[model samples]
Target: MASSDLTRKPTIRDVAAVAGLSHGTVSRVINGGHWVSPEARAAVEEAIRTTGYTTNHAARSLATGRSGSLAFLLTESQQLLFSDPTFALLLRGATAALAERAMTLVLLIADSPGEQANVERYVRAGHVDGVLLVSSHASDSLLASLVAAQVPTVCSGIPRAGDTPVPSVSIDEVGSARMMTRYLMDRGHRRIALITGPNDTPGGRFRLVGFREELGDRFDPGLVEQGPYERDSGNAAMTRLLERAPDIDAVFAASDVMAVGAIDALRR
Candidate 1:
């Protein structure tokens, strides 16, 4: 193929010719499909870099059943995820797992209902091999959409009780919440308060359930509060909890970012 025919991006064929290898050999190297001689792989890599070659995902998908690409769906803003330590940790873990599989990650930003519909459309279009969703709310329409798609999907955090099962890998949220709450109980805190994430989110609901399970029903009901999984929201929630229950001796904020805000409120 002529180089002029190349549009905005170079393809594996370009790299293959430059590397003096067959297109199949170049593809094998690119996909990590099989082991190639070091010299041959080196030549392909050099050519790839020189030509600025990228994979033709559509063609590859047609030839092979697998796309070798993973989609990560985020229902939050980049700013929120970057600032939240919990999201960062999850990102690190997901990145490591995908790297181990030699897969490429395509991040989909779906913070709103409209954006979520777009995600569904893309998935239905066979744009990716699999999907990983990190939802902030339980009973979300997006989760329902994903479940209906019947794609091999993995939920990054706890999932709400939904219609279908989506394979998931998550920290033992309820157990962790119990551990955190028990710590406060051990510290001679009687009237403790909790600032939980939204009740509709799996992480939020599970953590809140764990907290309540550990604290029991004897504590004043006013001490419990709900807020967004964010710093400012945590601060405001903590303030509200204090206003309602001034005797609250200890506070448990759902996320570390929220914890920071709770601590700030206490200090002030």
Candidate 2:
């Protein structure tokens, strides 16, 4: 064979020929080695290594009716999305998980109603196999649209309290908040104040519930402050709490950014 011909990109047929097996066997091995014998699998792997064959994911997706892609949708304003480390971590984790399964992750930021509508259309168009929803608000309309369209979805936090039932993965926000509050109380911090996230969010509401539950009689409505889950909001809330109760010893900010802001407020 000519050098030019030999230098061509190796295909599944080439691997099959080199392994002394049919293309079907090679395909089966590449897909998952489900029905292939151990000997055949080994031979195919060796042939793939020698031939440098790479699967064409686009072609496979087309043939299988699967996009081999997932959407990591965030329903928050651009400023909040860019400023929050939580969103960054969520993107990183989702990307790594999708890569492990040989799939791609598409990021969609839908903060406004118009953006949400566009995202809903794009997702409903069969572009991605599923969606990993993050930072969803209780009043966000995207969740209901996605559910109505029947697109497979998994939320980072529990969806609304009684809305569409979307599967999710999240820590027990209430329990964690309770634990933190209890620890503060144990440490002799009586006038413990809270800088809560927006009440429209599940995390925000649950954390407040847990804090109040843990504090019991000690829960002072006077020390409670509510704000957006932003640095400025945290700073403002912290300032208000200090003004309301100068004797406050400790503060629990709902998020890391909020905590930073709270610390800044204390310094001032």
* Per-candidate clashes, comma-separated: 2, 0
- Candidate 2 structure quality by residue, lDDT tens digits, 65-134: 7788999998887888778999898899889988898789999999888999999999998889989998
Best by lDDT: 2
Q: Write the per-residue lDDT of candidate 1 for residues 47-124, one digit (tens) a residue.
A: 998888877767878888777878888888677878788767767777788899877788888887788888889987
Model 1 ranges off by over 4 Å: 1-58
TM-scores vs. true structure, each candidate: 0.79, 0.91
Q: All predictions: root-mean-square deviation over Cα?
A: 3.9, 2.0
Q: Each candidate: what lDDT?
A: 0.80, 0.89
In candidate 1, residue 263 scores what lDDT? 79
